[model samples]
Target: MDEVLARQAFDTALDEHRPEFGTFFLARLLGLKISYPDETCVIEFPVRDFLFNPQGSLHGGVIATVMDISMGHLLRHAYGGAGATLEMKLQYLSALKTGSATCIAKFLRRGRSIAFLESRLNDANGNLSAVATSTWKCSPSADPTDGKRVP
Candidate 1:
């Protein structure tokens, strides 16, 4: 598929699946906007009390989750079907204290059965907060049970 169509399908699926964690949850709960700009997926989460850590900074797990989601979304967009993460590693570089943060994910490589991706999270001041890389196992487009594409 072309980039535009692929992005449309990916975003549509995201809305349908409503992935329960990370920016998906934050977007739904706080009305944050998620978009694909160029090769990267951008997510903006408004800093709120619910997302704060005990030390008054955003949780590292939260930053990791957003980056993971962004990576997964990019994989789906590029590969055109369901993909499950086989492994992931995240590195926290700095603390995310307040304001909004953005995640930029890029496709490193893709095969028929696997895809590798990397992403970085930056705070409002454009400082890098974390970086992550993930590998996903790409499943066939056809459903195993019904032999139809998953809708």
Candidate 2:
């Protein structure tokens, strides 16, 4: 994909469709920023009470969700339009406290139909909080004028 188009897509998604709940609750709650440079994708989220676990630490599920969203967002920016996750695996490495966190995801492979990505979440102090890998399947081509995918 062209670098300029990819960046434009990323910016558009953040401005228009980011802070997406259900899929990106933590990213919305924390005001995450997604960026792409070359093959790498980076997502940063601020820490807050809504994302805390019972013990007052950042929730593991929230961390995983951010990582997953980052991966999916990367694929969407790279491919254009939408893509669905086919599979994902998450590994939690450490506890995260209330602060800023950043998740970096990279494209491992990409095919016509599927894309593979790896993501890692880091706490404000730069400690590894979680790691995840995801596969996304692209949707079929959309009609040019209406911008809706044909069935």
- What is the C-alpha lDDT profile of model 1 across 1-151, one tens digit per residue? 1356435544654675465433454445543456778866677765554556788777777777677778877666655566898999999898877678888888776666766788988888999888999988876772222432322
Q: What TM-score would you give candidate 1 relative to the actual structure?
A: 0.73
Query: What local lDDT does model 1 show for residue 62?
Result: 70
Error of 1 at 56 (Å): 1.0
lDDT of each: 0.69, 0.71
Worst 10 residues of 1 by lDDT: 142-151
Candidate 2 residue pairs in backbone clash: none
Please list the residue runs of candidate 1 whose C-alpha ends up more than 4 Å from where it truly belongs after superposition.
Answer: 1-27, 30-32, 142-151
Candidate 2's C-alpha runs over 4 A off are 1-27, 142-151
